[model samples]
Target: MDVVAWQFLLLVNPNDEDAALQQFAAFRAALEEAGGDADPAALLRDVIDWKAGFHVGEDDAAGLMDALDELASRWRQRIDWGLDDDADAVPDTDAVLQTAFVQLRERHYSLWTAETGEATLSGWITHERDEEAMQLVAGALGLSARPGIG
Candidate 1:
C-alpha cells in the first residue's frame, strides 16, 4: 500500500491489514464521490467499523451509542449513558459524548473527534498512550483531531 493508504490502514484497522485495505478502498471511492473535494477527514469519518472506530451521523444518537459501545467492547469496557437505550427522546449529543469520553478515559482509552465539516460526529478511540501517535496520524492525513468531549 502507498504511504497514505498504509497510515489510514493502521488507523482504522491496525489488527487486520486486509480489512484496512478494504476500508482504504472505500475511502478512495468516497473521495471520488465527493467530486474530489470532500474533506479527507469527512470521507474517513464513518469508514471504520466497530472493530476499530466509528463515524456516525449527528442526529443518529443511537448509532453513536452503538458505535461507541462496539468500539469499547474491544477492550471489554462499557459506558452507562444514564438513559434508556430505547428512549425516543435523545439526550444532548455533546453531553452523551462527553460522558463517554470521561468513562473511557477512566479505562485509559481516548475517544477522538475530528473536524469533518459535516453534520456528523466522527472519531475513533485509542489508548491514552496513543494520543500523540493519533496526532501524528491525523497530521499525515492533513486533518485536525481532538479529544471528544462536550
Candidate 2:
C-alpha cells in the first residue's frame, strides 16, 4: 500500500466563540439539509469512522507539540496587537499579515505520501479563551505560528 500523510490546522479568535459555534451549527444544518435520502447522523458517523492509517515516531510527536506551541504564540501576539491598539485604527501591519496567513493555513491542510504508508492530522489551534467559540481554535493558532506562513 502506498503511504500518505496529511496535516491540517484551524484557528479562531479568542473573542469569537459564539460565532464559531454558530458556524459549526450552520455547517451541520447544511449537511442535514443536503441529505435528501440518506440519514445525516449516519452519514456523519460513517465519515468520522474513516481514519487514515499512519505512524508517528517519538521525535515526530515532539516536533508536532513544538509546532503547536509556536502557532499559539503567534496567535497571541496578533491578538495582543489588536487589543493594545486603537479600535478605530488599523492594527499593526505585521500582525495583520501574520493573522491573514494563519487564516489561510487553517483553511488548508498538508498532505504527505510515502510507499506503504499514509497519515493525516487534521485539527486547529486558538487561544484557550476561544474554545467555546470554535472547536478548531487550537489548529488555527498553530498554523498561524508556523514559520514562513504565519
- CA lDDT of each candidate? 0.74, 0.32
Cα lDDT of model 1 overall? 0.74
Model 2 lDDT, full chain set: 0.32
Across 27-71, the per-residue lDDT of candidate 2 in tens digits comes to 466566766664432322222221211223223533333334344
Mind giving the per-residue lDDT tens digits that candidate 1 earns over 1-150? Answer: 246645855754546678777778887887778874676665666567555767777878878888888877766789898887577786767877888999999988888887667677778877787788778878877777777752
Error at 107, model 2, angstroms: 23
Deviation of model 2 at 131, angstroms: 9.7
What TM-score does prediction 1 earn? 0.76
